[model samples]
Target: MRLEGRTAVITGGTRGLGRAIAEAFLAEGASVVAAARNPYDIKELADDHEGRLLYQYTDVTDERSVEELMTAACEAYGGVDILVNNAGVSRDGKIARLSVADWNTTLATNLTGVFLCTRAVIGPMTTPGKPAGPGGRIINVSSCVAGRAAVGAGAYSASKAAVEMFTRTSAVELAPKNIRVNCLSPGYIDEGMGKELAANERAWESYRGRLLSDRLGRPEEVGAAAVFLAGGESSYVNGTVVEVNGGLLWAA
Candidate 1:
């Protein structure tokens, strides 16, 4: 088991890629604390994983709630060994037509939330503090659109771009303390959340041509990358953005 005695805190872990990552961690023998705003199907997760899992209702946009999430994880497993800041939202609109609320909401959840969650866990995850183990890990979920100029994704692109930058800066700052930080940017993932945008066959066909990969990426593929990055196999890796887009945005 790559994470035999680790404890992981994953934000936005109720569903989708986050849920898949949480399960992957559990499979690797890590105790996981999955956090989101809404109550989750903990009974099901608990039934499968038993004492190795926990669920917390966390609002990443709020500092107090984020702190509470980290505190709960420490209380449960002594300290956090891994932190996944994966909570994000998209507000799609052209820059000229975008409202302030739309931009703020996107930035808050995608960029600011990551900062809050990282800050909440840094003291406990680093070496020069009252921590359980030596050091810990951090993974920020980014997007391929961050560097790409998508027409209707101004707010989302900007927010993810911030996430990427923050990932690099945080990694550099935390490296001395033995804490690793990295980013995972996924592209054209086959998930229900974006189904409404490409609802029609014609729209999907048009979008499909742009992708180098023939099919959309599966959620499990992203989860696999997360597992690798969160594990000891990636000890020398830091400030890197692992693209799990099936080679769609190769250069970016």
Candidate 2:
């Protein structure tokens, strides 16, 4: 197992992409804490995984909640070896008609949430005498929309783009402590937001041809990339954006 005995904390891990990452980590022998505001059928996962899985009530946008989540993970597994900032929300609106409330909600959950969770994990991950081997790993979940332009997605795009930059800056700042920060940018997948978007015929038509693959990506594929980033396989990889978009081409 590449992550044998490691411990990871994943925000928004109760379902969708985050849950997939949790499963992958567990398979690699890493104890996982899936942090989210709701359990959302996670107990079933816990039942299946046994002692290796836990679900923590965490509001990534709340500093206190994020802190408590880190504390809980450490209490459960001794220390945290990885932190995946995957909790996010997307509010679709064109720039011209975007509401202030919507913008705030999007940025708070998507951008600020990442910042809070990452900041809260520093202590647990860096403290010596803990079991975190070879330092720490921070995986920030970005999206294909961060790099691609789309109508009525200004807020969503901007938040994710900012997350990419934040990942780079954090990678540099935390490298000396042996922590590697990286971004996972996933494209349309058969789960969560991607699933919803693909359900819309108009949206599907607009994006189908852009992908080299004829179908949406599978959730496990994103999880596979996440496992690579979290485990020793990516030891020398940091401050990089690994896209799991299945080859998307911009319209000419």
For this target, which candidate reaches the highest lDDT against the unseen true structure?
2
TM-score of each: 0.93, 0.97
Tens-place lDDT digits, model 2, residues 114-183: 9998898999898877654678999999999898888899999999999999999999999998899999
**What does candidate 2 score on TM?**
0.97
Q: Whose TM-score is greatest here? A: 2
Model 1 lDDT tens row, 65-106: 998998899889888899999999988899899999999999
lDDT per model vs. reference = 0.86, 0.92
Candidate 1, residue 24: CA error in Å?
1.0
